[model samples]
Target: MRKFISRAAALLLAGVMTAAVAGCGKNSDSEAKDTAKKWTELDQTQITEAMGLGWNLGNQLEASSGGLPSETCWGNPEITKELIDTIKAQGFKTVRIPVSYLDMIGDGPDYKIDTDWLDRVQEVVDYVVNNDMFAIVNMHGDGYYTVDHSWLLCAEDDDKQTEIKDKYGKVWTQIADRFKDYDQHLIFESMNEEFNNDYGKPDEKAYDNINAYNQIFVDSVRATGSNNEKRWLLLPGWNTNIEYTAGDDYNFKIPTDKGCKADGKRIMISVHYYDPFNFTIDENKTAKTQWGKYAVKNYDNWGQEDYVDSQMALLNEKFVSQGYPVVIGEFGAQDKTEKFADYNEFRRYWSEYLIKAAKKNGVVCVYWDNGYNGNKGFGIINRFDYTITQPDLIAGMMRAINSTDDYEIPSPAGYTEVRKSAKAS
Candidate 1:
């Protein structure tokens, strides 16, 4: 499971980060000021294909407590360029860095991002782009659960909505300005998962506000000019859910980019897939451990291969078919390797099949690695050692990505009961 550091502990850590967090100096002069040089000539389809298989540097930069951001606050070591080099060596073509700028952001009207935090983020992005790989930097966790003055609330009180929008736009403006000169290799995602904090049916007003946020994000980034005017932007639907995003019910409008230099090809859709949460996450559940048709025991009856196909088809019909490429921003089954001896085998199967499905439907898939390497965790690589913890799973996924053969679902085997004590959350 992911670590949510206590506010007290975060406060203690914050004491050391005071200098870095408190400084709101002007942007550095090291940026490449050339806005005319074109880095990528690929259109949306080619750009999506270029992304290939992607990885998330999760739970690191996005880890925060009491509004203070710390890369190591959640038990992960400091991020090193070597860590990113290891990831690139493993065949990942893109790296998505989930970032949070809570207390790292100065008080409004400017909402200036702390200079140190912004530079640190740029340093990581450089690690990825230096390897000639696509890097996605996004506003993550600031829109998440109630904490750290998390203000990206789409369903804010009517009176407070202006403050939220103002903060959102100002923050994006600073982020865009900081990376304005970076090439097309650097992409900006509007927000991680901005919703009403409701898991039920989405609120129309909330959905409308999310659209407004996207528009603000697009306008704000474009206003920065430079390479950002044409930089590919990823937009998430309600909570980044496939159905809420592309399905008929919710309101998810793509932001209008009137002067986007990419010929209307700069916008991309972002959504996550964690269907049957009981299997992918929930540690309290004991039954849905193994997944897929061949799993004779401890598998979800639904969200099998057919469900994967249908969901991909939905995105293709609604988005991809119309020129907007859909990205499975996050998707993975957790490690229950200790709980079930054959768990990794099923994980390999799940990964392979999911990759095949995503590729078939013209979607890019980025695996979510939360940096934990045991039961209930979604890590595949040991971040500190830069070692592959789940070789078979990673291998299966790569094979699926490269394979052109038609994928066939395996026949279901007889069920076998396997139950374990639920771990306390």
Candidate 2:
């Protein structure tokens, strides 16, 4: 399900201004910007392929329910090296750490991020990259939450554009400077899913504003010097929605970066997928509990393998083929609901098929996990034990990714081939 505001709350904040003043300043030392590019340089395509399977460390650092900035505020244990090591051991090559700076930054002209908070975030990034896994640090849940007075909402308003741009630039400047010496494996995502009713729709002004913000992000990071000059950056579309992002109506454009132009492609497009809401994310008691070609009941007519093929094909044609790699930053089917009996097998099929389709289309997908081990939670790893809770799901994903047999590539018109099995059915 989409994070941030409830549908009702979103409607209420449609026209409201919840802006809070923020102060900004350069807090990192000159030593932090030392010239050192550690990781081997790879183009965006190679980087995307290298990422393989990924998982999100969600509902922890992004939690702000109790007005606290600590990871434990949401009931998840403090992030530890063992947890990241376990993720690497489970075959996940990339870890996307979503963080919220709502309570970590000081209040308008100067929004300075707390040094300790920046240090804590760096520690987590180190845990992932130091373990040889790709890490993505993004500003998550920092936008569109009415209660938090999101600056992202201001990005869409013409009146507040200057203020929002200033804040956005300051935030990225701090982040880029702090991690200036980190290698290419540590990617900086400009924002999470920043969108609202009008801004998320097919509004030209909104698209223009979003593009401007992305430009600010790229310019700010590039200005930090050192490794950031050619660092990989991920830019999200409206609400990170695949349809809205890849569709013809959004007028989405990749921001230009002079620093990355000479080094080859350094910008990647990001989108989220949880299609067929009735099957993947709908929490209603009457929601469809089963899906896939082999399902005997509750099978969704849409969002089948063919649907996956078409959406992926759209991305490949629109961006991947044009030199920009695509990252499905968040995608998953929840298994915490009791509404479905014997749901694990069906969920496994979904995982395998999605990974296979994404691979065929040259896209990288990262599963979203909110660390809930109980009802409606998306946790796959047991945080308490630092172990994988669902072995079958992980095995299914690995098998799909490791399979050597190639499925026929689908055309823009439609999919025309049947999937072949390389393992026991």
TM-score of 2: 0.86
lDDT of 2 by residue, 66-114 (tens): 3446676556678899999988888899999988887677766778988
List residue ranges in candidate 1 displaced over 4 A: 1-31, 34-38, 405-425
Q: 415, model 2: CA deviation in Å?
A: 23
Candidate 2 stretches with Cα past 4 Å from truth are 1-37, 66-68, 154-156, 197-200, 405-425
How well is each residue in 1-425 modelled by candidate 1, as lDDT tens digits? 11121222233234534534111124344335442354666787788889999999987898886678888876678999899998888888999998988888888788888888988888888788878899998998788765566878888777888988998999999888877777778889998877776778789999999999999999999999877878889999888888889988778899899758766678899998877676776566554777765566667767877798899889999999999988888888777767777777777777778888889999999998877777666777887788888877777877877778585533212323323321110
Error of 1 at 372 (Å): 0.7
* C-alpha TM-scores of all predictions: 0.89, 0.86
Q: What's the lDDT of the predicted structure labeled candidate 2?
A: 0.73
Clashing pairs in 1: none
> lDDT (0-100) at residue 192 of candidate 1?
83
